[model samples]
Target: MMKKIILHGATNCGSSNFGDFLYGVAVYNYIKENYKDIEVGFYNPSEYFIKYIGDCKISLSKSDMLIYIPGGYFGQSHKSRFIDNAIQFVRFMPVGIKAIFKSIKIGVIGIGAGPIISPFLKYPIKMIGNKAEMISTRDNESYNALKSLGLDNILELSDLILALNIHNLSDTTDQVVDICKKCEGRKLLFVHYNHSLLARDIFARQLDTFVEENPEYQLVVGSDCLLSYDDEYYIEFSKRVKKNCIQFNYDSPFELIALLERVDAVLTCKLHVGVVATMLNKPVVCFAEHPEKTKRYYRQINQPDRCVSLYDTSEEEMLSILKDKIFEKSFVPDEEIDKAKRNFDVLNELINKK
Candidate 1:
């Protein structure tokens, strides 16, 4: 019988990253709506682990269960360095260890893992996976990665963001609402590019060409990450594209979803932007820099061709794909959303097993 569950992850509680923020929102709402009786608390490992001796320690000590929410926290990618991966593992190790010592059941849901190069890191991660009462991954690649570490009883689940009911969550900004109202007749395409990706000028030129060709369509450039650099990059990119383009200043996840719900389609390098657009039944063409997670997600939804290489794919080809996607009937199947909800089934089962 679980009494309290601490959702531990790099979630919205301490994050400005819209994707992680939405994941935290989705999981929290799910638990509150379904369980009703269980006490829910959020513990952001990235922010709180540094001050582990304070509220972090107290929260974990009192929790009956610690649930690690969805994200690509467990593996190495082009965007994340080996040192980054090591630091993340280090932050999580103490939390997991303390949870075990306190007899708090641990659950990992809809997480992604892979390409763990170091044996030293692998050993400790394996220990946590083996000790976890329930473990599930968002993709098969992640499942295989855990399987390589000899972990068993892992379930494959969809991304938790799919389970989010965007319509139910209100709080759209006046700016976004007004923009949607103004662009009633024109097709709006939500565009987000990773600022760190190489060849910004080239990508900007490609977008300019796409806009020039598609005069009926309007571009709304924005960042999924609310960092200074991302905002700066989009501001500059918006200038270079001498077409119908508006720079979106991200205020909140609710506003982001509101804009996404109104958009005709999404063209982005960020994984969650594509995921959110898909959830809204909007077509998305992903310019993947770190292609693993994005590619895996598209493939999972039976649309592998939508994920394209950011650098390698030609501008003309990208424009063609974007045009096709904009008009096509692309949507996330109802079954996929149903599958994502099952990520919580393990936790529910544990709570029921008096």
Candidate 2:
């Protein structure tokens, strides 16, 4: 009999937030490609289970394992007060607890965590960790955060999306494909920034100056997720770029990958945007959003020089970094790939155990 496994994460496939959707897709693809004998499904706790416990109960009846994929949702990092973040931290506790109560094997893959200063979150974190069959964090900071809570059996791994097989995106010629084809030889620059990270007006002026200076390059501004603020921010940034800048968003991970493959480099204030850009072998210049989460990933891959903070650097300084990166040659480190492969290998072993 084929054992059923659920790969749950913040997946809203083709969500405006492209990175989360990619993580979900990467988890799905990893299992399908490596564990052919097992049946797999993807779940988003926020989207699917809040109103449908009965559906979860039915799915859990046949499920042998539950593997939570990568995301920053596990910690108390959202823009909320102590009580609010505390409330959010336990948002998925009912589901995880239900899985544990039923004795279903649980695992976590390439997840992020940090600055979890609150004692209130410790119990639930421990509860989830105690139930996990395998635990692999995407960065050292997250590993340390979880370790601070006494879960020392965790493995540190690269973000799962780095190991994602994005070549699958080229199977069809959708709008993303069409854009890539149309701009085949033109040097493309992809930009994705978060409003929460920096002042949009200042970022826009810097972007405008960068575009004006580099008139030869094509500027494509976009959002990693389609959250209301994402479009609002992107649209605002576009208006500031006196030079022509294209705005685009896709609802398919494959389409996003197809579009990313054609970009020469990426400039962003989001972690996953930088991760996906590096996975595609493009140079990434990042405005550090959260220190531990954003810079730690680059440092793990041995590229700390790529990270800069908007607060610490002027727009000119930021543009200078972008200028250098535009001409810079970049490649993925072999050790990083090996580390990512080991992550899935361990995850697969945990799932296949009798």
The candidate maximizing TM-score is 1
As for model 1, its CA RMSD to the true structure in angstroms is 3.6
* Residue-wise C-alpha lDDT for candidate 1, range 61-133, written one tens digit per residue: 8888878878887776665666876776765556777787787788888888876666545776687788887
Q: What TM-score does model 1 achieve against the real structure? A: 0.89
Worst 10 residues of 1 by lDDT: 48-57
Model 2 / residue 300 / CA error / Å: 1.4
Candidate No. with top lDDT: 1
Candidate 2 lDDT for residue 246: 69
Model 1 residue runs over 4 Å out of place are: 12-14, 45-58, 181-184, 197-202
Q: Evaluate residue 220 in candidate 1 and report its C-alpha lDDT on the 0 to 100 scale.
A: 83
Q: In candidate 1, residue 49 scores what lDDT?
A: 27
CA lDDT, candidate 1, residue 237: 77
TM-score of each: 0.89, 0.85
